[model samples]
Target: MTAPKANAMKKTTKPAGAVRPKLAQEGFFGRSGYFFARALANLRQNVFVSVVTVGTISLALLIAALFLLVYVNLEGLANGWSDKVQITAYFDKEPAPLAVAALKTTVKSIPGTKSVTFISKQEAESRLRARLKGQESLLEGVNADVLPASLEIRLDREHRDNFAVTHYVAALKKVQGIGEVQYGEEWVQRFNTFMNFFRLMGLLLGSFLTIAVLFIVSNTIKLTIYARKEELELLSLVGATRFFIKAPFLIEGVLQGALGALLSLLALAGCYFAFLHNAGSFLGVNPAGAGLSFLSPLHLAVILGGGVLLGFIGSLTSLRRFVNV
Candidate 1:
């Protein structure tokens, strides 16, 4: 046929007046739909790669979240221990009952003092008897006068720190009736040292983990960018706006981050419950009974938001190398 035209073999071209739709010209809803559709399509196009990226992010976040849980519990335990810290001042001679009451009133006015109780020699001896129930006969010669009378001072939360407690003790020494003021100097110093060391370790570990997450996420996104290099370049050549080219990628990253965070939270919940269930025999401890708690609402929000931020940062970092900005 005079040759059936080679139209079937010819490359199709748009009419001279035809042009691609400009997102800026569209309404807000239309623009949003376009972006979501494009992002979803990209995800579908590389389903396996997307899944892997999300899984990696979830695993990384899970490890960090787990450590956070442990650190929070340790902090709570430290606070509880701090509450038990008390200062006991031994008297050279038991103060008069009126003097003891006045001293108690004054100590209560001090910055860190929570409660103060006067322990008479007789009361102190009685306590020892109660404590040494099995060896009561050992106190045969011990009378009420044998045990020293003291004032027991319980400090408020803020004053439990070594420096604060020491300062408070010095203030006590300034009082007229006090002979010796002690708050377990050696033990307080050691407890503070341990707490400081533990906090430093947690900070270092958290920082390193954060860096690892950013680095790995960035490289993963970079790999994705490389896969679509030609398509992006072609769009640029056709005069697609920079925002148009980058919007889908940004959306994709946020999606991955959100999905990863949710998945990690679910995994964390499962692990936490499993541990709690088995703790009775495995660790011989009752977590709930000991005042251990799960993440608070604020903590949960921070972790979820952090995941989204990581994804956005990862995508942005990868895109900067491929796209101009």
Candidate 2:
């Protein structure tokens, strides 16, 4: 009878490790369902407060998104300008066929050279005439040969700075058959300095705006939490874990943030299309000759993530500061 009883016990009982996974899965699903339901109930119970909080978050995120877009485009423009920094090396005489080939090869071999384009006197004169537009007739009697043939040298990005350009210009000036090397030295230096300053200002402004959004959203969430204080207290009284009580509000915050971010994205898309349709020419072309781009895939992800993080932090603040449970 004792041996039979031991065999029956072994048949009825299972190992703890095997049972734990199944139990944990059920617990997680059950907890998630409960939290979702509670969050929906909270929203339904305070429709006005919910709208107000979501609206506030939407506006804040919209403003933040706009600044990010502007900063990104301006930075692109700055880089485009940097890449366009070129030195025009004018020749004393029109280069011979063999000399031109050798000059091209020599310039291409330069350490920092990005590209070298040889412009003939005729091409230079034609460009000048195009620029002169209505005043092109002023060059009616002028000899095309008076305009010197030149080599346009674009430097690599790392060598585009003022110091690097100065050294590059000096080196090019020493090359045979080159009369002068001209790059907008003073202006390029000043522009680079300005770009650095602008980036710094943008960073500071973004930080301040982010903090403002957090404070506003936290206070707004606080109002919602205050309205449901009694319910929260009752849940605590019923032996609900702190995680259980806070889970719903946390979910609510994230949903609100995501919704706000979605709304902002829609608004931005509309504005982007409207702006491009109305003023495509205003934003200059990139090196590829295409018009300016909207936020990249990575940046769009960042904006959404930023919104969710802002909401999570606000909810966490309200729960810790006001709700004991």
Candidate 3:
């Protein structure tokens, strides 16, 4: 009898692991479909609260995403402008052509320097004429001989920081025949300061918004659990496993969060399109030339993942307290 009992125990335990793989291979689509249907039924049962919770989440996510989008674009613009940042070292007088070439080689060899191009006095004069556009008469007395022959230096991205650039400028100014090293000092400094401020603000705002959404979702889920307390008690009395009892609520939470994220994305897209259609030129963002990207595919994936995580957490929190009670 003992041997048979032990054999039967092994038979039961062996199928447990094997059954899990088979069930998993069956895929989640059927389970997900059932969960979605149950979630919709729950939402319909608690229409007012569900709408309020979803609306709150949507508004919060939309605002956060908008700010994030703005921050990303601003950072990209700043990086682009920084890459174009070059130091023009003007010569005190017209140096020999060979000397200019030597100076260009020296500048190119400097640490952090990506490229150095020699700007001849004649080229500089022509550029000035083009810039002035029909005001060439004003530069009639300005001869190429007097115009400075400079070396325009491009720095690598790693050395694009203001302090590094400033130190490089100081060193470059000591080079022979180089009189003044000019760059957008004030503009770069101002941009760095502004970007820092925006980053701090984004952090604070994102934190507060995340907390607010979490609280709202958790409370909503709590109320939902409370409403179905009697049914849950009945399930518990019937010896239903905890997993079975909690599965539906967890699924509902995930559905709520995912739906809210998707709705928010749609609403933001609509707003963006409307703005572009009406005020594309006014906004200074070209409609045709690299139109605004709302979110990258990676960011969209993160949003969906975040929604599912938040939903799961809220459901778990609510169920924990309600089940214990």
TM-scores of all models? Answer: 0.85, 0.74, 0.75
- Residue-level lDDT tens digits of model 1 in 76-191: 87777777789998888988887888888887888988889899998998899999999988989888987789989998887887889889988898887779887788888888
Better candidate number, 1 or 2, judged by TM-score: 1
The Cα error of candidate 3 at residue 208, in Å, is: 2.4
TM-score of 2: 0.74
Evaluated with lDDT, which candidate comes out highest? 1
lDDT values of the candidates? Answer: 0.82, 0.81, 0.75
Off by over 4 Å in 1: 1-30, 95-99, 289-291
Ranked by TM-score, the better of candidates 1 and 3 is: 1
Task: Return the top candidate by TM-score.
Answer: 1
Model 3: per-residue lDDT, tens digit, 1-325?
Answer: 6999998988777544555444422234646666567767877987886776677666766776676666665566556667767889998887897687788777777788998888888999888889999887898888877778888888998787778888889889878889988988987677667767867887897788778767876776678678788877887888755766677778877877787778877887787677734443777756344234567778777776766777778788888876642
Off by over 4 Å in 2: 1-30, 76-84, 92-96, 109-112, 121-148, 156-159, 170-179, 273-293, 323-325
lDDT of 2 by residue, 1-325 (tens): 6999999999999877775445433343667987898888988887898888888888888888888887777777777778768889999999986789899888877778999999999999999999999997798998789999999989998887777888888788878899977888888889778877998999999999888877877787788778778878898899877787788889889888887787787787787778843443765444244425688889888878877877788888878865575
lDDT accuracy of residue 151 in candidate 1: 89
lDDT of 1 at 319: 75
- A best-first ranking of the candidates according to their TM-score comes to 1, 3, 2
